[model samples]
Target: MKLDNLYIKDDTRNPTLSFKDRASAVGIAKAKELKKDVIVASSTGNAASSISGFAASAGIKNYIFVPKTAPEAKVTQLLVFGSTVFLVDGTYDEAFELCFKAAERFGWYNRSCAINPYLVEGKKTVAFEILEQLNFKVPDYVVMAVGDGCSISGAYKGFVEFYKLGLVDKIPKMIGVQSEKSNPVTRAFNKNTYEFDYIPPTTIADSISVGIPRNGIKALKAVAESGGFMIDVSDEEIIESIRILASNSGIFGEPAGVTGFAGVRKLKKLGLLKKEDIVVTVVTGSGLKDLKTAQ
Candidate 1:
């Protein structure tokens, strides 16, 4: 469906409630080849649930580390999937460090975004699906929220690869959105520097409140190469985006999912967008993943 100068589609049935299934789908395939026993990953929400779901399907044990600040709905989803959960008193970055040490100590397969190259393989499929569904026609822009940047990077890679394979004629520009308070990437992009000092705990956007994005450097490259722009949106704008997406497009997405729309709105207000422009903004997760934020 089309909404707000962008095309929106639902990716709700990938066994997990969020789009991280695409990452886990490929991670599981690689794990079998490595003959790994345990799968370890760090997530604020959907990635943890997805890893647990896929691990069970592949008969592998799963360990998930998450910040204590994560939303309850996401924590509950991971619990219901029977993942071995570790709640860290520190931030998401600290939880990532602990998971990294554990993975190295136990030789567990790592599905974390920054450390795992194959994780992006699964996420790339979403872009492939979009292009094929459009019958080889490429859009002018593809928008998505940037957390670790894995998903946006994956989608951009998919578009370029598909173009090389004669599946599509061209690659679309990528528009990346990050939470204003927690947006290291957007800060870096504007400053043209690699140094970014993260702020303290924030309730602005829980799904994207990481102090430091592990894949900051690569995520910047994705935006630069795709001829795309990155912007930050306020918590207020994100809340409004959630309502607008659900009401206008018949899609119930979390704040992170609709933040891309918030960015698109920024472009339109700046007179950088047109009504006839074919754009795609990804709904990264179901609204049920964060009911409190949705409400």
Candidate 2:
């Protein structure tokens, strides 16, 4: 609450109530351009819903596969948006695998992040919006949650694009946050190891409980090139962050959504953040998607 020059990129304001909308919007447009009438994707919840929402509005058919354990609210969102939802019996990674094969079998346009490079292109828009929102002033640090790592990678890509175009003086140091239960990227970063070890995810932040991040390599490169790092927080810390974000900033966000803010606190504690440092953290999803967990 007392931090100075801290900014929240409230992506929950998007129509689908998550940052996934941004990537899905671009994916949908690409599908249209390619004349692909059927779109397929997989998610723990938010990505599926976002893609379905956009595809519905565009009059495209969308099929989404999610883990059976996905939040009820997100499942309802997919159903209400008219997407064919597949509740896979296995984990999110399993759902993603199924969606991949199904998309190939059905010849549907795949909107999976990292699997579909265009999704990252779509997400990079967040960086442009952030810079423009701040009148082209680059922040000292940019932070966000990492799951498949597409979102953070996309943001990094956006900064690179802007820098190439001479639109910004410099890119901010990127910080990626992950749950301790799903901390592949963080562990790799801490150990200077790029190889990923897939582990069973056991976090209440289901949206980011990625065992094997599809974009791990790109994400590592992004952080390395940007002179940034990754860190992790416990589920308890993430829950506390959700509470702090809401109480202090009046922005209610899901556990994964508020993970970046949790990273901010971690950085603050480690003396990595200074009072004059301008920081922006992405609030990736609405708390409404997992209201029960918040309680």
Candidate 3:
């Protein structure tokens, strides 16, 4: 198993400065093809910003509803990129719900996670890129942060579909990370079911502090089907991992992005991960999005 640490598709080469660009690329293309004018979304940070920037590229008007608690740096991107931004009065989940209601009531095309199947379809390209970058080699483990689970589900689906296409040898065990306070996915994974109430909110990984994970069932299945596992990290660990990653690998990752490393560390401590194991941990967004956390 070849361990390739350098990010290719997840690299910061996208114009919008985030991995969500992969999904936004497809979303904007499809929305343009469908002739949708107004695009609406809700995000804690990167997802909405990505779509907002991409919508601008497509000459489509963007409406973003983000939690007031999301980092100012992220909100700044939306406005600077020329998208209309709304600061929701509640949590990210509340913000997402408001966006969902607006999409239904105002007939806005929702590009939000899980709520839109198209976005998931777009986000799934990460797995395809990983496959191609690896020269059709599937890693022993795939680690990532879990937000609304659209990207996780999308990437997992890509692997499943790729196997069907005879493009990949097998699917990797997918390990998803969530903030300790908002680890419904991890809770469900440990409890061996999807019916769990663990969404209390968190501070470290804002992008993934999902109270009630939208794609709970599918997200759980993605791990199980991939012969993978799930884990959680405290805000402190997530923060420390940022500096650790930057110091060791020169990869400056935000708290959300650092969750993958947190998972790697925790798995390593538990002796669940082998040193020879080919592990690919996805750093989802640029650390610059939340400079305070990294500092």
Best by lDDT: 2
Error of 3 at 22 (Å): 1.6
lDDT of 2: 0.93
Write the residue-wise lDDT of candidate 3 on 162-184 in tens digits. 99998877888888888776788
lDDT of 2 by residue, 140-228 (tens): 99998999989999999999999999999898999899999999998888888878888899999998999998898788888889999
Give the C-alpha lDDT of model 3: 0.81
lDDT of each: 0.83, 0.93, 0.81
- Candidate 1 structure quality by residue, lDDT tens digits, 183-265: 88888889987666677637456667777888877778888888987888888988998898789778888878777888887
Backbone clashes, candidate 3: 0
Q: TM-score for every candidate vs. truth?
A: 0.95, 0.98, 0.94
Check candidate 3 and list the clashing pairs: none
Candidate 3 has what TM-score?
Answer: 0.94
Off by over 4 Å in 1: 1-5, 201-203
- Poorest lDDT segment (10 consecutive residues) of candidate 3: 1-10
Give the better candidate number (1 or 3) by lDDT: 1
